[model samples]
Target: MDTIDREEVDEVCALAEAGQQDYDARFELSRMLLEPIEDEASDSKMIACCKGCDHCCHLRIEAYEFELDSIHAYYLRELNSEQQAKIKEAIVERYPIVKDLGDQEQRSINVRCPFLIDSQCSIYPVRPMSCAGYNSCDDSLCKRSNDDPNDTSFGIPQDQNIGYMKMRQMALVQMALDLSFEEEREIISGMHRRLFG
Candidate 1:
């Protein structure tokens, strides 16, 4: 629940503006800004999300354009042909299933992320801001929701400070690049479009 300082926000915005041409730098800056908050949460054991937990990965993920650019770049640059082919196949298969559905309906179904390989994120380092911001404090709630799509009775606890900072940073980045928050797109469809079209 800590508030981000104005100076920090201004600095990030200025840096983002200056580095407008570099999506990698923008994405790294966004991640750098959140590292401290993530560390604190981890130190306090406030996060229930752990390795091998892919519940959230099954949910819908939406990302800003620059974020998607970073991910796409990473996918091409870091992964080998085999890895890339597997992810492409997953995206192609999953996109048709979720494309026509609304966000709520997408979340209601357990559609796996293309990046999820063996219950782990293949592109963990360059995950979207929304994915980075999500910090579930109760794995059981996540499990419940994942297990029963109808069980929306409880909400997962997250660090609001992290969420707030992520939004602020992304907004500033978008402004710097002359982009709109409205340009955000669902990750799977976005990736599929990028990969195929």
Candidate 2:
């Protein structure tokens, strides 16, 4: 993984702390920071992820509260009432199956994310930073991992720079939200609470 630049992180954090940027701006900043890195990685022709690949969506996803809030807002603003209802129903049904699962079980199971519709992410534009940061260089390896839970090889190739930059951007967001890392929660449960409660 690439080393995080302390100066870059500090600058973002300072802007966040100054109360100059809202959630949208913060997320946009994250996108701006990641764009060049993703472009460089893509030029290598090693990125295997594509629009119809939802294998990774089955994995457990954790995100900060602010990230979840951003998704929720997007769902409410961009989707119609029927679409919202369907996703909420899916979350309600899936939550019980996943709510009590241990971390390992959650990771091993293939529960589709509530936002996944017809094998595509319905909230792609506002996907969490964790999702934004994830990349794979081998679609076959990803399929193997997703197809068989016992396949614990985790041998998928990834761009370390993308992951490291995402971590730093997340730190900047945390500082902006005045939240600790511990505030992060499982995505399904977070959405369940947001939609139902």
Candidate 3:
């Protein structure tokens, strides 16, 4: 796995500081920080995730406030009224059940992501780090997990640097927290707040 260099981390921190109020800069920084994880996943042959493979899309999609802001921008600027209405409908259907639940509970809700269209992420380019971080070598495990929420078979290999990715996520969250950004929120609630608030 490629270790993120200290210099890179510092650069990301600088970007986060400067871009706290700049949505595009913050979004770009998020993607840059995530590049190493993607590279490592590719190196390990564990990055089998692709469009139309929407198993993980059913899992809770968590996002930082800035990331949610990016998605909301895409939602307003890109989606047609009908598309937006359909997503809002999905949220209306599922948000009630998952809204008060904790993060882990939200993940087990088994609802397709509101932004999933024809089994592809409608906001792929600006997807949150949480969504971007989830990579699995085994498609079967993804299927099983999607089929049975209780099944523990769904897992990415340890060699994929999940721990490293998680640590990087925490660092980013801490940076955001220091800047008074909301820690994180599940996709449905986050989007609802972004769209309606």
Top-scoring candidate (TM-score): 1
lDDT of 3 by residue, 67-98 (tens): 67778877877789988899999888877877
Expressed as tens digits, the lDDT of each residue in 1-197 for candidate 1 is 45556666667666566446775675666576556545655665577877898888888898876667778878987888988989999998898998888888888887889999889888887787677777787888888888887787888898676666667656655544556666778999889888889
The better candidate by lDDT, 1 or 2, is 1
Compute the lDDT of residue 81 as modeled in candidate 1: 92
Q: Kindly indicate the candidate among 2 and 3 with the higher lDDT.
A: 2
* Model 2, span 49-80: residue lDDT tens: 88899889888888776568767877877778
Candidate 2 residues lying further than 4 Å off, grouped into runs, are 1-44, 178-181
Those runs of model 3 whose alpha carbons end farther than 4 Å from true positions after fitting are: 1-23, 153-159, 169-182
Q: Point out where model 1 deviates above 4 Å.
A: 1-30, 33-37, 178-180
Ranking by TM-score: 1, 2, 3
Model 2 residue 145 CA deviation (Å) reads 0.8
Better of 1 and 3 by lDDT: 1
Candidate 1 TM-score to native = 0.81
Q: What clash pairs does model 3 have?
A: none
Error of 2 at 103 (Å): 2.0
Candidate scoring better on TM-score of 2 and 3? 2
Q: What do the candidate models score in CA lDDT, each in turn? A: 0.76, 0.74, 0.72
